[model samples]
Target: MSTVSTHVLDTALGRPAQGVPVRLSWITDDEVVVLGTGSTDDDGRVTELAPDGLEFGTYQLWFGVAAYAITSGQSIFFPEVTVTFQINDERHYHVPLLLSPFAYSTYRGS
Candidate 1:
């Protein structure tokens, strides 16, 4: 079976970006044939996505970080960051984000 997860760390705050609402879905119908979504936890992580597992397809993640920044008195130049990736096999996809108000980065994690 395949699975997906993510951990978001606020680089500017030096802590996890807690309470952020993140979702994983097919960006467009042409992107994939199905839909999936999930939210972040206190640890700045999405522990489980694709409960039924995943197959070879393209996927997009809608990560909302604006609320957290606003509550922290920070300014988010990029209100949200969307990551698009592909699942090639039955393995765990850990997409991690190193975030900041004005800058952010993501990569294929463990």
Candidate 2:
């Protein structure tokens, strides 16, 4: 069984993106199944997006940025961000997002 997690950092504000909504989904051959949903904590971390454990396949992490932008009083080009990745083993997967109002990036982490 694999575990998945994520964190979001606001590059413009130089702080954790607290209260941001996040959703996890498993992509199957025929459909997408929602695994879990959560909001980032004060530390901008959703430490367990998949409490039920993850399988070896493609999955998506969808982040809701519009609400964050509204609260921060910033205009963003992308209201939402979705990252798709493949899980191949029983190791832990950490996906961290570096975000600004108009731009965002993600990378695999330990």
Model 2 residue runs over 4 Å out of place are: none
TM-score of each: 0.88, 0.97
How well is each residue in 1-110 modelled by candidate 2, as lDDT tens digits? 99999999999999999888999999999999999999999999999778879989999999999888888788988999999999999999999998997799999999
Question: Distance (Å) between predicted and true CA of 44, model 1?
Answer: 0.6
lDDT of 2 at 41: 93
lDDT of each: 0.80, 0.93
Stretches of candidate 1 exceeding 4 Å from the true structure:
27-34
lDDT of 1 at 97: 88
By summed lDDT, the worst window of 10 consecutive residues in model 1 runs over 26-35
Query: Model 2 lDDT vs. the true structure?
Result: 0.93
lDDT of 1: 0.80
